[model samples]
Target: MSEIIRRDPRAEWIARNRLHPLHAALQSQNQTVWIGPNGIVRKNPHAIAAGFIGPAGIKRIDRSGAQQGTGTRRSASVEVQLPLHVVEQPAYYVAVVPDMVGGRLSSHDKDLLGLARRLAGSEGAVLAVVFGEHKESAFDSAGVDRLLLLDGEQYQGYAPEQRVLALRAVDNQFAPRHWLLPDSRTGGGELGRRLAASLGERPATRVWQAEGERCVGRAGAGQQDIQRPLARLILAAAECAEPVSETRHEARPVELAWQVARNLPRIEDLGPVAVDPAQIPMAEAEFILSGGNGVKDWELFHRAASALGATEGASRVAVDDGHMPRSRQVGATGTWVTARVYLAVGISGAIQHLQGIGACDKVVAVNLDPGCDMIKRADLSVIGDSSAILQALIERVAAWRQEGRRDAA
Candidate 1:
């Protein structure tokens, strides 16, 4: 019979992440000795009491349970549910229009919500106005006090004119104190500008920091910061504020009083055009499959990227080696990407590379060296050969597509 050893990634991640809600509980359950919050070493007397006097003068602890004939199994981890932070009646509303890219909240969206939460601050409610259908189910965790979803065929696709009309309707009904939107290229920025124009309110664009009465934003070419009084409409940049992790919100449903009036759009979206992954700008790409010097199979890497519908990126080393074009390079010296998911293959993360992907929501690393800097920075890391990993990923993606096709048929 073969002995099987199972590894729990979630437990491992929780153990490594000290900020996680269940981190302390997991640590207490696993270890007898740990450093306290005040930098003092604390020991468990119960764990020490488990030891007994051996045949000699020394006290012994049977960790393997050889004497007991059966080894003790570790207990399962219990889920730690956060306490709800509810607001039954809000004095005012701080509206947030998130750029729900890929039908989910991006890191930028979360940051914007955090800022809204701060602005709302007990008396005011954080209203998240979502356009079209969304796959997001964590609005409470995202610090949403109220959710207003405008889902219809007209709201779908690139319809800035229609969206502005909807915002106008929301403005008329709710009369929110402040309007917050993600200042990114992914429709949010444009929508915000349009809404601001429609409302005749001067918006603070590229705002990175906002507190009581004052807001700080980047000036021309990202060289200087312009600090001014908080405006009614604010277009916030990424990392405007830390995401809501400590508390949960009520996330009550909100409805519009009347239907939004629609007008004929001058700019027509002729559906989506099929552009090559390589041609897509790295900064705009939602998902990126990047390669490094450790990647031995460039063809296989490209195949994997194609299979996964991911834009291609390369580390500086890979670019210098002529494996990929200079445009495909992703780093501080190259293109800084804000991809939602950055899958790095065989990249021993350079400082510049890490800086470039600093805005990325999630990073997954595939590498042979477990102690590499990329592995440490990655949300999820797979220690293995890059070639084998890419091949397996391609196969998995193919199988998933085939299954989808079968279901459709």
Candidate 2:
């Protein structure tokens, strides 16, 4: 990680521009570290499929009374604009590749790119993307230029620590004024904070699409709403002193950026991006799925999970076992996912693991021993083979699908 040397205590003078230095500096230090690789994605503006893990729409089992298939279809489509990718100038942009779990140029990425193209001032942009573990990356496979790939060792799996190290390495080497990393989980937050600390400055979190929209955050256990007059991420600094026309060549880089950040949206504005949770004391989410030791090979584990629509998650065991992405892994050293419903499968329910996700609303356990401590902690327990339970669950979903078909006819 790039260490930001603090401002020399002996220095008698400092520049006003230093307030927003091109690079991140450690608090009280002169060392400035580059930070970012903002992972972006797009919102699918058009119609999409429902249910099952597949592209677009998933096919449903058409029933004629028996357990068979029909050539029928489901009517599901969302309205969307023609997808176009634009480019931003020197705005700090990094291209991150998603693993099998992710894909290139998702809808969110497209939208982010659109924003860069539409709003960025010239020469104020930089681009880098994280391409997940791939034998041949977009850099090698295509003639596409301007896409920087972070293929560090952590690229193969979701190794948060490793990724932090790699990001620091890039910042020190590239010297890009601003770094943009993924705004996903706590690991990303940890990296941002640690990176800012190394640089010696309180990092600037969650940038905005346009200027004037302030992003105010609240810290408490209640519900509130912060409405935006414009459709954009709040808390942005406008490089352009004056408002310019949309067609100005100086603005709009969405089309070119889409190739790298597929998950972006088609519009130039976005909702308020979140500040890294690591930097502040905030309540965690209200629901989580704690994947404990019960997760066998990635197949049986997630396969059984797919049978249920709950967000599939993992404990440190799953990550260490390489069964789940480090991003999904939960524990003390990892993220804390607090959900209303938490399912602990095969987890020993070790205090360390529980400490990470114990704030769950309802706990469910599927363990071999009905008397396991986790079972006691759970609101419901099924004393049987966890794998068998999953298989049965899958069978039930299949049956439900059949029933739905019959009801429709």
Candidate 3:
């Protein structure tokens, strides 16, 4: 009797697609050992099913997927360059002021840019007005047609008055058809209101939809929808429109025609005050250390979070078990976080939890189960005991802080 081999091309394709929703699960099943881009070899001990016991009762192990002469492997390193959307001589401009939190564009900022692109249409340009020093390097992909940087000492810190002055100067030069800003607590909402007051233009607030001449926004505590003619300025809510993913823009730099007029400072610029990570709101947190059912030591977990300077988050099960407060829970039913780094310890990565951290830039998972959902979504995965990992992490962070102090001395 001969053996028959089977192949599933669809499964292989899904495994190679990093953007697919099932990518993590499919890859976890198909791969046991793989080389990362940094030349580090990662192995999944639980996925070592490449061979079976022979008739002689001798176990066989094959690194290659070739079982019974039928196996396939594929890579997902091919980069697809989007088509360029060029506006040579724009008839008008739709200026957008993004809330570049932590010197980089947030998901809110990108959503606002997507709305700006819609307003610009085919003939007009999307002018991005940036403030202070920025670390963003992908302006072209973010759909910026004209980049206007207002980087100055005056624009730094909590200077809404100074920012309004710069925006007024932009108004005099470009005279854009419309102004768009994010309607969040982050600097954008306040700045937009100030700009509207400074320019004496009635602005639409909490706007979610915009079309040819009319825009719809939330009114009366978000229970009612008000439709009105599009105002000169608009403060849009998050998810106003889909982000620009199909096309790239020029991101051409533009300079102001004249120097910005300065004014007497009313608010003194005091340096930032250090706040505890647990006190920070989940939506506004930049780094999070989350724990799940696999975490056995709650006291050590808290210590590790404090040492790492990360906001504490917990899984639904942890919260239900009274291990953490409901406010610190991270999932679809809980607060959605847009942290730059989300560290999950012993989490199985529920669908709701993954949805909550979908906007995070990086996800690092520490778990005993290599085939867990969290490991699939993690940018880096460490298969180990949660308590040991946390203890080592706390020690490492303490040593790093001590070295820094010594260097200063």
Candidate 4:
């Protein structure tokens, strides 16, 4: 059997620009800074290339460092021209690599698989690339048509470089058209971005909706739409709410040769530390008590949450203000919670914040603003001072506990 070979354009681009500072930064694993051919310094060339002009398409100064024009002013605005050489025909399969959450497949993983199935349509096959030790039978129940298991000791860690290497190896052989990954911090978000850069494909991140080849999302507060070609890569900030039905499918297992990466930067694992489970954000916590900007007293919020024996979570505002660590942030940009009961104290409820708790069974909002979006969506709304309400609730709970103890005595 003849092995199929495919050329990676991004690898070629990096090889050609090996002498450039940007390329050097990539190799050294330092912050990426780009000095344009015209000597204009940019924080990131990828952003510039995507938004303004393609880096390879940029005109460079001559060896003498002189402009080609004779004192002619350059145009203020430059039109971006897509690279013609990097275009490749779309493959027949849509590839999905699910991110493991808490040592198992999370809702994000299921949603990514669902999206892949939708995008695959009728003709294309859905290829699921699973890493680490997982029940192959569980994936067989997923809507995936084919499963590629890459399991070994090296694949055990959450090293982004190792995951990228594994994915790259699979891509080299399969040449899949669309690569779907979870847009998560510990997941394939960074890996997807790196893979896109390495493959010279346009990466669409934080995609909320996919209409055919176009992905819809928000840039800041403004609506942003990215049109992906048939052969492009997509990193969806998965927001699928529909429960995936148990589908029986014959999953064909593919065995791909795995090689341990050499000279790659290894992510240092700060071994587990002993801490109160309630202090940390739990992905599978049943009851979550989250604080927002409205809560005046951080100490009181923590005390109340601890008293109630609920996992603590914070809004983006609270997290940004340093009231809480980012690990406990519950929002679109933070941890997604599927808790049975979510108590939002003082949170005004931005759409991004609400998106994080979409899977909650019931939402209880305690905010001064009765018309806040959070209050509107909340199953129970308490319109009052958040701190006062929290203090009263804590006192009442304490009183009940004391009364119960006395009666028992």
Index of the highest-TM-score prediction: 3
Q: lDDT per residue, candidate 1, 1-409, as tens digits? A: 7545456889979877644546656765545676654568977543423343432223446465453423342222323356688888889999999999988998899999999999999799999999989999999989999999999988888899999999999988889999999998889999999999999999999999998899999998999999999999999998999888767898899899888887788888899988887778898898999999999999999999999899999999999999999999999999999898999998999989999998887999999987778887899999999999999999998899999999999
Q: What's the candidate order when arranged by decreasing lDDT?
A: 3, 1, 4, 2
lDDT of 2 at 129: 42
- The lDDT per prediction is 0.87, 0.45, 0.87, 0.71
Clashing pairs in 3: none
- Give candidate 3 regions above 4 Å deviation: 1-75, 406-409
TM-score of each: 0.73, 0.32, 0.80, 0.48
Candidate 4 regions off by >4 Å? 1-91, 135-137, 221-231, 240-246, 257-263, 272-336, 339-409
Per-residue alpha-carbon lDDT of candidate 4 for residues 260-355, written as tens digits (9 for 90 to 100) = 464355577565665564855557676899999998999999999877878999999999999998889998899888877899999988878888
* Candidate 3 TM-score to native: 0.80
Candidate 3 lDDT over 1-409, as tens digits, reads: 6544455879868866555557766756576678754568977543325554422223345556565345542223324456799999999999999999888888888888998999999999999999989999988988899999998888889899989999998999999999999998988999999999999999999999999999999989989999999988999998888777777899999999988877789999788889999889998899999999999999999999999999999999999999999999998989899899999998998889999998898899999988778998899999999999999999999999999999999
lDDT tens readout by residue for model 2, 1-409: 7765454433313322222222123223322223323333422212112112122133333223332233332344532222223443344433222221133432223333433433333444434445454333322112112455554333444354455555555555445443433233533445555555665654433433333333322223324423333322212221212221122121121222222212222234344475432332223443344566775545665665555555666777767877767777676777765565677778766656667665554688888876556776688887877777777877898899899999999
lDDT of 4 at 24: 39
Per-residue error for 43 in candidate 4, Å, reads 65
After superposition, the stretches of candidate 2 with alpha carbons farther than 4 Å from their true spots are 1-290
Write down the worst ten-residue block by lDDT for model 3.
Answer: 72-81
